[model samples]
Target: MNRPAPVELCHKNMRFLITHNPTDSTLNSFIEVLKRYGVTTVVRVCDSTYDKAPLEKDGITVVDWPFDDGAPPPNKLVDDWLTLLKKKFQEDPGCCVAVHCVAGLGRAPVLVALALIESGMKYEDAIQLIRQKRRGAINSKQLTYLEKYRSKQRLRFKDPHTHKNKCCIM
Candidate 1:
């Protein structure tokens, strides 16, 4: 079977691989493709649940943040997603995060765009970037959300030795 490959969106130290959900038959191939991109985490935003055991067995972390189809994620979920990205990058600079929501067009791309915006790219630029790479990405509602999104303050991290807090800007 010919499986569609994931689209990669990389900006500086942040990298995201967005694709459709894998089925029982495609899971192995999906994992291979993810490995090629050095993906360390998989974020599933769709309502459908899959067996994460295979992905986890390959040493990839799986995060579930499900929401209704065709709707923007809750603010708290967005915040948490960003936080996870920040921490993941801090721990492994070269690792990539794989995101998917059924078709890899809507929610997955929205989250990636938000991350790009937080990483200092303008919202328009972010949307354009994702659409360029992963055709038919954000929908009208998601695009509106991206247009109005104001990035939250950068998460603070403490220096282990100095015991001082510092903002780790993406």
Candidate 2:
């Protein structure tokens, strides 16, 4: 029997869900839901209009990531993002992680895809998850990155080694 494609989880499980365009109402709603589910970490890209008080009101930790402007985040920035997610994962191994940007099609999906990639998800699977969860579009740079990302992986599905560049270490 053939297994069906994994449905991208935008709901829970320390899973990374991308919400491309989150209005104030939507953001508040999501925060409330996450609070109910006990999700602690919420990484957001820079926004002058964003108010952190809502998250604080709900006791969720919000990390401001200014590198999500539809550009391929720098390697150092990506490293920092991974480090933050790692720390969050370690702090509460039972909580869900959701990363979001303006439209979820650019920085959010790319970083989340990288997270899935690091979490042992195959390239196509990771990208598919992002597309399914976020939107069908991941921008040009992200798509290019994914194609190259999958190509670098060993066909055997072994873990990737520490990368040396911003693109992909596979």
Candidate 3:
């Protein structure tokens, strides 16, 4: 089965490339394309068994955060994961970080959405923007988490009596 190619998520300011896991046939091409995009680092959010040694040898820094598909990492891991991406962006302003899971639709976009939220974008807008870039970017379960996260934020700051309607319904 032929999989679709990678999609570049953002271009106006900070850049991120989102794509599915590369197979043996697509590995070399993936590296070349990422280089063309000025991607100096890769965040591998697929299973640990998916080898990325080739990418590492190509001089692109790759960080692994393996987990099953259709699920987000633990809350603590999510925090640490975002921290690592933040540091990478700080180290090189021009860097394009490529993030991927098996299909780049579910898990990869969740991370991208969270990063955008951290970068000061509203969760709704961030998800919309990502969806524009790559259709079906986040699955329903992932969207639920984003909504839950947003609701938690509102709960932490807003008065329940005044903002109960604005908080998460769940």
Please tell me which predicted candidate would have the highest TM-score against the true structure: 1
- Misplaced by over 4 Å in model 1 are 1-4, 153-170
Against the true structure, candidate 2 reaches a TM-score of: 0.70
Question: For candidate 2, what is the total of clashing residue pairs?
Answer: 3
Candidate 2 regions exceeding 4 Å error are: 1-14, 21-27, 149-170
Error of 2 at 169 (Å): 35
For each candidate in turn, the TM-score is: 0.86, 0.70, 0.81
1 versus 2: better lDDT goes to: 1
Pick by TM-score: 2 or 3, better one = 3
Candidate 2 lDDT over 137-160, as tens digits, reads 478777787667532221112224
Q: What is the lDDT of residue 1 in candidate 3?
A: 57
The 10-residue segment of model 1 with minimum total lDDT is 152-161
lDDT of 1 by residue, 79-134 (tens): 89989988998787647999998988898889888888887788889988998888
lDDT of each: 0.84, 0.62, 0.75
lDDT of 2 at 154: 16
TM-score of the candidate numbered 3?
0.81
Query: Which prediction has the highest lDDT against the true structure?
Result: 1
Ranking by TM-score: 1, 3, 2
